[model samples]
Target: MSPRPFDHVVGKNLTSVKFPVVAGLPGPEGLKTHLRGHLLRMSNVGALRVLVTGATGYIGGRLVPRLLEAGHQVRVLVRDPAKIRSVPWADGVEIARGDLTDAASLREPFRDIDVVYYLVHSMNSDGDFEEAERRSAENVASAARDAAVGRIVYLGGLHEHSDRLSTHLRSRTQVGEILIDSGVPTMVLQAGVVIGAGSASFEMIRHLTNRLPVMTTPRWVNNHIQPIAVGDVLHYLAAAATAATSESRTYDIGGPDVLRYGEMMQIYAEVAGLARRRILVLPVLTPKLAGMWIGLVTPVPLSIGRALIESLSTDAVAYEHDIDAIIAAPSGGLTPYRDAVALALRNAENTEAGWDGAAADPLPTDPAWTGEIVYTESRDAVVRADPQRVWEALLHWSSRHGHWTVENKQEPTLLELHGPGRARLQWRIESVTPARTRLHQHASYIPKGLPGQLYWLGLKPLHRIGLRRAMQSVIKESEGRR
Candidate 1:
């Protein structure tokens, strides 16, 4: 661990400066804000202007908000400014229109920027995502070198400590090399499945576990991985901007638990309070057939589904336990996969609960119910503002004082956090008009016998009523906000 550079933000040589302890702040958010101020003060004195690329992507989207909150004047490199308008702080960011493939466009974004966060990847992109990712890395590295950027922060994938790497993971490693070869100090953080809302991997797990009752288990499901929370990943990214002494080094970032995907599904089921399905695994299942099965069952696209499923055979846990030396020190304690999933679901649920009004009613309940034991929740709020304003509140509502509750097998106490309506089990959100928001309740409990099925069937109508009442409460709350 490195010393907290209380004054290093002002351009004092970090190696020589003695760090002072920071005064007490409320929490991580507060500490980040203070750090941002420190960094800005340094920038004013000619330290380094920072540039964040891939602002439109998932991790990048979350990272930008933290950066802006920290008081860093961030310039986000994006291909289309319009794609960013829906972003919460769209107006706040200094949007630089530059695609990685276009070298001419990269010059403006790299110009005079002290630190650049290289976050773009093509694994999710259409055919030849690997080649595209490599090319993009090359273009950015060349432009950054030409512009004399001091350091580059990159996030890549973690794989087994072997020469045989999955195409996806291999390209990620290559991308780091391209940036390092460009003469800039580069700190690479390699991570496995990032567990959180809107994360492709997490969502896949969520949908799969929730929708399947009896699944033809793939051998990949038995493979082990150390999953990290999205929040943790962000902390590392922020810390990496200034933590590393060696610019050309890599760090292995993972969660506290090394869990099998099968175990993960069982945890999810338990936490969500759904009945644990009996999983039957067959060793004969090939990655190709398994991927097609996933495509048939889960919402994951065929391309990524194929790539990810194939990589499961290779252990993605920490490679050399010593890689932490390069990346920034770990911030708070690591969140478990079950807890992370609960938080993510709650975040998404809370957001969904905010979309109330006439037009959004009866909101696509079955839009995508391909998962097992599907827990579909909808809530609506009718505010004086149009759909846009209601949607805004939904998207950015969680960070504030109002907390959302999600059950976790590891932490049963979280169930109490949902309040009385949630005791019934299930979530709902509805909006009759722009001015009204509704929270819906839809709960399905564990089945024990004929009595259990009868009891659940009998209560099905009541669940609908409960859902409507929950929606009503949400609407009232939204109204109170004004």
Candidate 2:
């Protein structure tokens, strides 16, 4: 098959022209074409205004900042305002509370937007995701057409061949078609497993290798595929909007080399410093079994895991090398799998700013369990002091004690606890209803500066006792009354 024609090349800027699209944009059919031209011209100045859907999503979160950096005014379409608030540019972005399934909410966000990125997909929408995607696409297309939006950009799955497209891939393609059918010039960039921090595919590899000593593989593990770095993917997305000529094109973008899933796992294991274990692949290890095993070990939700594994039967390696014709070679070129893994780990090391990471009150030791070098304890404590007193105790819980740290593969540094002397108690006492104050203690140790019980799992009994005493000394500080 001929490689899909790239309507525009890298660095080419697309401006709207007077066409049938504009002529048809009047009634319920909408004066979308004409409006698109005007909106494009209005945004062509130094500051182009772009609206991004799914701002809180993995791709959306990273893509928003990239757009802003490229000198575009970015607005986000979000279902829930609170979720995207933690984004670094939270204040800068204009958030519109809209859902793809509901066309009514889209009109507000679609108004006066020059380019719309339809990055929203309902993978977890439950029961007929295809229908959900179709409806969402139709709704967005209608709204964009009505609002006279131009240049819809969609990021889709890498399809080796149209005849063998998986349901996921097919639905994604259909979504792009729906947008194009709206008479809006659209550019679709399809890519395979995006390797980067917090990406589902990368996380699957992280947890699977970290938790399991040996993997019982499936047949799909031998399927050939090309994985692209998330950074590269972001570059293409940004490049797509600026390319003047590349409208109404579908570009299959991927890494330089194609490797089987088994090789991919081996590369990951090497980068992670894991043991080169025997991967016993049995023909009978069906997709169902593989999905169950993945769910057991990885952070991937079962439903999504199953869908992902089931789709692995076909090779997703890109056959078309058309992307090279449009854009210049990236400075770093295509990222190797091992290099990608290392970068992702580095990024994971700095995820403290994530909203889900804030600490609550500390508690007492409950039932405890110890891993290879990590110890976990759960406890509930009722202190007679005020919440402020409890907070002080928890904050300083490791101050006087030996810090618990875990020596992992990446760095022989701390896993959970912040460095000593830097731990500050930041909290305000809410309404103190009663004399008894509640506390929830959650302690984590990094294996550098401090010694905690969890970090002594494989150590000698004496070392474990010594560490426990050190920790207890710190916990004792909180026992004092307010």
Candidate 3:
């Protein structure tokens, strides 16, 4: 990177930034983008006024801020207004309450929009998801056309152009066709599995690879897939808004590496520092059976697992690289599969910022007893003081204590203590009700072998005593504070 661009990388840890590198152009580029967008937002000059659906979803949530940094005027449309009330960027954009399935509801939001970003989709819903997806896309198309919207940018899934496409990919492709025929200029950037924290496709891969040491997998594990980084997807989506293209079209976008589905899992294991997983591909396993197995073993929900598995049943490698013409590649390049997974893992260090990490470790959401046997002990108490007071009290206790260091903290909410080798102590503070707070302390240890097991056994009683004393001291200090 040039010195001018690298200079913009100051005041931020490039590694821990939300978007890890397409191998750190994402971080520095992200910073540079933010600087430019901030200036544009301040001047209110030459900004693209756009409306985005799915603002609360994984991609939309990340994209909204990027659009803002690009100095674009963003308006988010949602069925429920409260869904976006607490987001960091909520105050920065206009929020319109409307249902995409209801064409009448979309007309108002679609009006006066230079670009319409159709990022919403009905995935794994209770009703007919395909019909819902189609109707929603149709409504968006008609509304954009009637409102004379300048551009339509839709993020769809990549798949081989075949009648045999799975239900999920077929619906995605159909939605693209509907938008392209809407008499409005649309650019459908179809991407394969997007690798990032909080992405559904990536989450499925993370959980499955982390938890299962061995998999009795489906035949689709052999299917070729091209996975794109979330940053790259956002990059293309942002560019799609500005590119002065000739006509409405669909373009396939992906990372530099393409590999089989099972290969993705093993690569994730390598990135995550886990033992290579064992696998036995059986022809007898169907998508339904495998999905059920995934649901049982991993944190991914059954409906989504089934849909994702079905999509993976066929090769999803990008058929072309036509998108290179409109938007130049990232400064470094697109994040390769290994680098993307590394970025995802690196981003996991900030679990306080709503990143669901520790797929190979332990998760609060994963099914109980899914992976290796982990021993944990938890203690909870209601405190009379507030969270901040309790945190201060805990800090005081830690300062007086020995052999413990602050591993990570979320201020008055969570404080983590890092111990030697896989032994962890977590203190979670929550508001039970008005003027009442609950402080929960949890300890977990994953023993390696006989000696490790003996170490845990030896520390078991000492651990209990230490936790009780720490809780007592913190509680005393908290209630004592004014």
Candidate 4:
């Protein structure tokens, strides 16, 4: 939660900044003219009152801090404010409770807002998400029109328009069209495969690479993708707000390098310092089967895996470079694909703990207290070191000769360690920040028969104390290493 290095970029004089123009686009003089006009438009408006939807989502969660640092008055609309309560920037902005499907709830949040960032989507919702997305977009467009919002900025999937378009891509395209036609100037930045820590795509890649030394593939793995770094995407989203444009426009945003999905996995492995994985590209594996396999092997849900697999069947490379003419590249220009992976890995390594809040009860519902009695005990600690350090410390604990056993002998039967994924007994290191790590230790057991139940009850107090002390030991050891 400490101040980010990019805080200086906010509230700075835009006119003094120099933006790079892509080849075949405007030259330096033309770039100067465009900047003059853009700055003039920005000056006339002064500071903008921005309302951000999907503030609980990955991109929206990161975007809020950037907007606030840029000196904009920010407000967030969410169906459940508790979802964002633990965010480092939560206390700095206005919070309004509302759902996109309910148009009535949108009025107050939309009021007095100059720009609206529509980051909401129904990809993970139950039932038909496509229909849900359509309804949500229509409601948002209507509400934006009613609120007299000057502009709307949206991030959507990058894909070619075709009868064969995947449902997820089609839904994203439909939402963009709806926003554009709302009579409010809307800027849509279409991108594919945003690489960053805590992102679904990145997490899938991380888990798959770390756990599997070999992987079976689908034919879609050969399809080309132009993955953009989350940092670059954030840069574009933040800059689009100030670009001088009178009409709605769509820009294709991507990184400098284009590679196939399989190549992406290889590069990630290389960056993460894992051994090169052997991948067999089997044409027989259908998207459905691939999704099921991904779900079973990694933490990614089948639905999300299917969507990602479907999108990988088509090329997502950008055909336009107009975004460069508008917003300048970051200080070092667009991050290369390998560099982006390395940065994401670095972020993962430095990830802090405590951001996930508390672990959910692992037991299933037992209304009548019949059948086997199940119980779970969890201990969480925030360590000063990064997740990588915490993970290494835990690995050391697990590898000790007879540490986790009773009496330090008899084959160490006290507890077992399992996972890099969703194993029953596991220690997970989740990233909260660049310098902090959250260590979550969990143990679950189901007692069968009366004797087993009595045994668990008898040892419950000791179990609690042992788990808490173990977590404290981890924290102390990790801090010492730091």
Candidate 5:
């Protein structure tokens, strides 16, 4: 770590940001108003050159855009840059090809970077994951120091110091220590279960509460937890990159409320309009059994779910709020647990990421089971005609002048319609060859409440038949055309 600690965490030589203390407004929300307003008013917007790892991940995916929004020049390092090519913000940042476990691959990405966001630590890595993470951390620490990177910001799991810490939390703590001691200033933010759409924690709670009105067993659900929203995490991360700071230390970050894991699940049900759930904790249910149960209920893979479930066995409440000294709470104080859940619910249906400032929309990489609950029926066919012909046929068949109107379009390739009471129909024209085109038609209905649920149940069979006929008609029309 740097002498007297803290590089203001951005560049070799940089002036620390100074903000006017907000007063008289009262409470935490008032205190939060100063930092953001001051930063935006700065003459130097987008001054820092930042590099981010894990660009495709849930948190990193959301943070990159915020950094860009702050007027900072951002670069991302990924093994396959193509993974992020379809993202709306893909073209806005520089891309560096690299692998974390391989030290040599990080050199170019770390070069001339003002701050390095070490956002990745994966259990999915081949062989021993602990060793893999240790190697990855060592590689990042060495590369950043060699490049004289101003600071390294890492996100770690929040847990108390104990001999009984789960393997997941222990590995995270080790990685944080390695970066802090790398002789480069580092800010390790240890956060509890992250609450957001597509986040594993949120999805785990979502499926469990949504599917099982009455859950059988895990005593871990009674453990205390202090989960934070993804938005707040991103806020602190984006701020930490440029804020005046001097510690190669760990900061515990979490939401305002401290509730039991089961209480958190019930809160989720409240926010989502679901009935209050009944949780029956069975002390005899082992972690392995709990993991298998979660696997059966949720889309999160067994490997990840197992680790997450194991960590839940310990209380995860934050030990301190020392981070407020460096970066203020996100605009309106820290997000309360209930509001965070509500925001995540809103994010579930938001196709555009961050259209709402606090919305952490689900990413393409999120499990297919995550996001808005929509009943869908789709059909596709290969027609002996060009895309234009198929598209014409698609448009003709989709037409219902009084009931449907185009929602979005992309020439002869895609057409989406919105109408007939929240139902969405879309067509895609793909050119398989000069004379052959693949036409796909999809119908999706997003149900709102009990009535919406019953509506789908009643109309599902009719929907399947109608969708099949619609695609057949389009394919026949296009194929029969000259």
Candidate 6:
């Protein structure tokens, strides 16, 4: 069979357009004509002034870079602008502070925006999240319509239409319907489990597989699901920004492979290089019971776990492939499930590395007049070595020392080293005896403002753990040297 035309190459810029030979027209001339038509359609669409909600979320955070690469003028609507300060594309795009539930805050951000990507959802919120989501969607749709926004693209869950729809899936579908009914040209791309680093579903899978070698799951494990890569989802989302489509369209999107939940776990185990896990499916475990178990084993909260577990009871395979005729398939074709898992794992590793590196970097030195010290943590250890030996150990304890705490991986900052009795900058040492040295460590931060205080309090636990680890490492190294 002939390969499909315009297969997308994964992990590259979207500029690579290919045209294959058609059956009816004459050879190269036919291909050239088709290519010209495709280019003309693309030109007619042009670049859009796009507004993205939920810019700090896993999918939205990643999507911003892709939209920027495609040369679109991007504006991000975020509740807190500081949340996106570290984002790589934060500086390149316009940012407006707004909340979807607050209709007053939405109008300014939606003004003159050609396309609005409605990515916000209240899945993790406490109490009546479904109602909250509906209200927020209503506000967004109304705001976009009032501002004359051309289109709205939404990401929703894939589920078969039925009265027994889970609350999560029901809310997703309802939000899409609300947007469509609001008279905006809305495109809803429905997907099942999104396999990507930092995605809630993928994280749950990762933790469950990594932590449990012997698993006993409910009957939902047998339900069929099609997990799509976050990359492909992003591709479709970016394409929807300009792809010609019906006024209000709903597309079910998934990866090439469909597997049962149990099969997905097995594949994840394989990709993660874990030993083959044994599974026992019991028919009696309720969603609440399963959620409690998941909450106990994984970092996911009970609310989210229950919601996700409820949705897993139904099959989520796509019923249509019409999206391919509109938006081109990924360059290298759709990512296989295993390949998607692998990519997610690689991204996770890179993210962890970045986090560790950030933790190890020196903290900003605040001037004394900034404010009063808002946070301080201290630790002390006595080493059975001379002062000189302890000093030497301190001098050499860089990030490579690997003695930092398991949680934050924080390395000490040396501010001062005077003779054998004094060392400073979060650490100080004094020789109590010729063969015994007393080491004291303290992390002190003066509040630059309210944000500084919040930052210090937020990381207090990690800071404490890091201080303890630093003192212990110094003691061990000094004692060994003696």
Sequence-dependent TM-score of model 2: 0.73
Better of 2 and 5 by lDDT: 5
RMSD of 6: 13.1
RMSD of each: 12.8, 8.6, 11.8, 13.5, 9.4, 13.1
Model 6 CA lDDT for position 240: 88
Per-residue lDDT value at 444 in model 1: 37
Please give me the total number of clashing residue pairs in predicted model 2.
29
**lDDT (Cα atoms) of all candidates against the true structure:** 0.63, 0.62, 0.76, 0.70, 0.78, 0.72
Candidate 5 local distance difference test against the native? 0.78
lDDT of 1 by residue, 1-482 (tens): 24222333445444443222322324444433433544454444532356999776667877776777665668889788887776557788788898898888898788767679998886563678888888899888777766656568899888887787777778888898777665555778889988765566776776667667678777778788999888888888877665636436677888888998888888877876667867889888887888788888767777677777766777788765554554444555777777777766553333232213111111112123212222333443334534444434433442231444544312211111242332324333344565544433344343322334455578777866766664444344455553
How well is each residue in 273-318 modelled by candidate 4, as lDDT tens digits?
A: 6678788889999887988898887667777777777777788889
Give per-residue CA lDDT, model 3, range 233-292, as digits (tens).
988998887775635789999999989888999998898777888989999999889888
lDDT of 6 at 89: 70
Candidate ranking under lDDT, highest first, comes to 5, 3, 6, 4, 1, 2
What is the overall TM-score of model 5 with all chains considered together? Answer: 0.77
- How close is every model to the real structure, measured as TM-score? 0.68, 0.73, 0.76, 0.67, 0.77, 0.68
Best-performing candidate as measured by lDDT: 5
Of the candidates shown, which would achieve the greatest TM-score relative to the real structure? 5
lDDT of 2: 0.62
Deviation in angstroms for 277 in model 1? 2.8
* Model 5 residue 343 CA deviation in Å: 1.3
Candidate 3 local lDDT, residue 91: 92
The window of 10 residues in a row where model 2 has the poorest summed lDDT is 358-367
